[model samples]
Target: MAEQLLDVIVRKRELQGDGVVVLDLTRADGAALPLFDAGAHVDIHIAPGLVRQYSLCSDPADASVYRLGVLKDPASRGGSAGVHAHLLEGRQVQISAPRNLFPLAEGATRSILLGGGIGITPMIAMAYALEQRGDAFELHYCGRSRNHSAFLAELGSAPFASKVVTHFDDEHGRLDLAAVLGQGRARVHMYTCGPAGFMDWVIDGARQQGYAEDHIHKEYFQAEVDASGEGFEVVAARSGKTVQVAEGQSILQALTAVGIDIPISCEQGVCGSCLCDVLEGEPDHRDVYLTDDEKAGNDQILVCCSRAKSKKLVLDI
Candidate 1:
C-alpha cells in the first residue's frame, strides 16, 4: 500500500504504566484525523532515519485524536527509545496515514482478542470497535503485572468491561494456553498480537484446539527474518551497483551498506513496505504479505527477508 505522509503534533503525553507512555497526536493544522478501523496502526517518523509502526489504541469513532502507546524497549535499535525519550507534548512528528494489517474479521459471530505485554494496544482498539457493533467478543490481555500494564483504567472502564480478562506475570503467572483456549472452535475467530514468543504460543494453542488457520489472525511488531538463505549477489540494475549478501544479512542490508537506501518497515516482511521489483532472477520468497500469485510470478520480492533463489539477482531498485 502507498503511504501518505501526515504532519502531526504530539498534543499530550502521559506515562501509562511502567516504561510505557501514551501519546495523543493530532493533525498539525488542527483538523479531523482520517477515519480508521480497529487494529489500525501508523508509522511514526521518530528520527532522521527511524520510523516505527505503532498500533492506534484510541476509539476508532474519535477522529479528533490518535492515541498510541509506546513501551521503552531497552533492546531497541532506535525506534522505541527515540519515541520514548524525544516525542513529548508539543513535539512535531511526521506520521503515515493509518494502515491496518490486523483488521477485525468481517461477519464473525464472536471474537477472541489475545494480547501480551505491549501487544495490548491493538486489543484495546478492537474492544472499542466490537462493543460499538454490539458484538460478543472477549479480550484476554496478559502483561507483566498490573503495574506494568498500560491502559488498565481505559480497558476496564470500556463499555464491554465484563468481557475483559487480565493475566499478570507477577501475580497470576503465565497465561495457561490450553485452559484459556480449550474451547476454541473453527466458527470463533481469533486475533493475536505481541512478542514473537507470545504470539507463537497463542497461535499454536488455538490450532491445537481445532481452530482453522484462517480463523486465527496474527500481527507481529518485530520478526526475526529467516537468514537461512545461501549467500548471493544482488545487482542494482539502475544504479549499476552489485553487493554480496552474506548468509546472515538480507538483500536489503547488503544494498543499504553500499549507501543505496530502500524504504523499509516491518523488516519482518509483513507490511510489504520493502517490496522491490525483480528484474531478472528467481527469489525464495519468505514473506507472509505476498499473495500466492504474486509469489509464483516472481516479479516482485520483499528484499527485507526474501533472498534470490538463483546465484545472482538483477533488481529494479
Candidate 2:
C-alpha cells in the first residue's frame, strides 16, 4: 500500500548546532497529528522525485507537533542541502505518517541508548518515553564536540538529565565501546544509532561481549550499497512483461522504465518500501533493511538496491 501523506506547516525552524537544524512541524489545519512511538521516522517529500527520512525527536506525550533534527550533509544528493536551503518558517510541506523500524524491546529490565552526531534525534524521543514510564534507562550521546551536537542544552536541562552522559571526542578522546557494553547483558537491551563506523563498533563490541542479537537494536539513516551488477532479466508475473536489468541500473529503475510503478522511497533501500516477493530466483541482497535470516530465505527482495544473482528472476509484482 502507498504511504499516507499529510499536509503540515513548519511551525518553527531553529538552528541547533554547527550544521544541524531543528524543525517543528504541525498540521496545517491545527489538528492533532498522528501519534508516533519512540525511534519512529517520517518521510519528507522535499520536491518532486526527491524524498528523505528524518527521525522524530520530540516527546511522544506531546501531540502538538513533531520534531526532526536534520544535518546538512555535505555529501547529500540534494536532499539535506535542499531542506536547509528551501524549507522555511510557515512553509507548508508534505510528510508521510510515522513508521518505526526500531523500537524498544518489551519486558527488558534495563535499556541503554547510544547516539552519535545527528543520530541523537531518536534517542531523545526514547528518553522521554522511558522517563515517563519510570523505566530504568541510560542515554549516552557522543559527538565531535558540544558545539556540533544538537539538543545539548535541552538535554542537559531535561528532567532525565541525571541519566544522560555525553562524550565529546575533542575532549574525552573517544568513547570506550568496550567499557559501555562491559556491563552484564542480563535482561538488558542496547540501542545505537550513528555514523557507520561508530555503529559498527557498538554492534561488534556488543557481540564480542556476548550480547544476544535480539537484544541489540539499530537503525541506519543511509547505507553503503553497490547496486550496479551483472545484467539480468526480470519477469513481471502479473504485468506479463519481461525487462532487462542493466549492469548500471537497479531493478526498481528497470521496472519503472517499463511503466511499472513500484512504491519507492529512500531509493537506497533502507526504508523497505520497495520490497517484493520472489517466486523463483536468488537475489543478490545489498540492502540493510532485511535481517540475515530473511536474506538467506531468498523468498523476498528489496528491489530498490538488491539485484538478481540468477540469469532470470520471476517477480510477483
The lDDT values for all models are 0.89, 0.90
Candidate 1: minimum summed lDDT over ten consecutive residues — where? 178-187
| Top candidate (TM-score) | 2
Estimate the overall C-alpha local distance difference test score of candidate 1. 0.89
> What are the runs in model 1 whose C-alpha is more than 4 Å off?
1-3, 226-229, 238-241, 257-259, 279-282, 285-299
Clashes of each: 0, 0
lDDT of 2 by residue, 146-187 (tens): 887889888989889999999998998888877876765778
Model 1 Cα RMSD, Å? Answer: 2.5
TM-score of 1: 0.90
Worst 10 residues of 2 by lDDT: 177-186
Q: Give the CA lDDT, 0 to 100, for residue 58 in model 2.
A: 94
Query: How far out, in Å, is residue 59 in model 1?
Result: 0.3
